[model samples]
Target: MSETQKSKPEIEAPQSPAPEALEIVDLVEGDGAEATPGATVDVHYLGVDYDSGEEFDSSWGRGQSIQFPLQGLIQGWQDGIPGMKVGGRRQLTVPPQLAYGPAGSGHPLGGKTLIFVIDLLGVK
Candidate 1:
């Protein structure tokens, strides 16, 4: 199905232990432009905590896509979003070190693995 035809995505709860490294999965591959490092991206996304399967954020919930420079996001996003094409959907499983940091790093999500489903809408 085309990216435009798909509705908001729902992430299934993971049954396995979180990995020690980053994991990337493309749910839908878009045919548009490829996103390069340092590019600004417009995307719709959902974020959930790996252990509790609880949602922490989602652009879909707000009924809009967010746009930002790729370099300005968290480590996981900075590492994961580049090389994706606009119109594609990708899932990222980010370990704590690549996410907020090891558990006591002070960020609310510190020490936690995060799961994110991202839809690339545009790249600039």
Candidate 2:
């Protein structure tokens, strides 16, 4: 067999399962209650590629959280953060539809399962 064919099984087998097939890991529960779509929130986050567990971005290294309008972010963020309260940490496994979609939207996130560890620091 060619090298490409031999390696294909090894690469595809492990990552074949869909993101939805994996369980979510919730680390902390927020105290201030859940967020809303238009709410501005301060959050510390780490984004990784679900299949690879590769670090994509992190706010914790900055020694501060970042703030953004929930509704303005990717569908994953908009849909995922509301149930989270201030001071809560949750993992989001976002399927491609809720993530960068097909074209990637400029970031390195396109047609992939995006994993996010989010800490909802505050609401403003």
lDDT of 2 at 18: 58
Candidate with top lDDT is 1
lDDT of each: 0.90, 0.69
Q: How does each model score on TM-score? A: 0.95, 0.76
Query: For candidate 1, what is the lDDT?
Result: 0.90
Location of the lowest summed lDDT over 10 successive residues in candidate 1: 1-10
> What's model 2's TM-score?
0.76
CA deviation > 4 Å runs, candidate 1: 1-6
Model 2 lDDT-worst window of ten:
4-13
Cα deviation of 87, candidate 2, in Å: 1.4
Candidate 1 on 25-116: residue-level lDDT in tens? 99888889999888999999999999999999999889988999988888899999988998899999999988899878889999999999
Which tens-of-lDDT digit does each residue in 31-68 have in candidate 2? 67568877998887877776786677777556666898
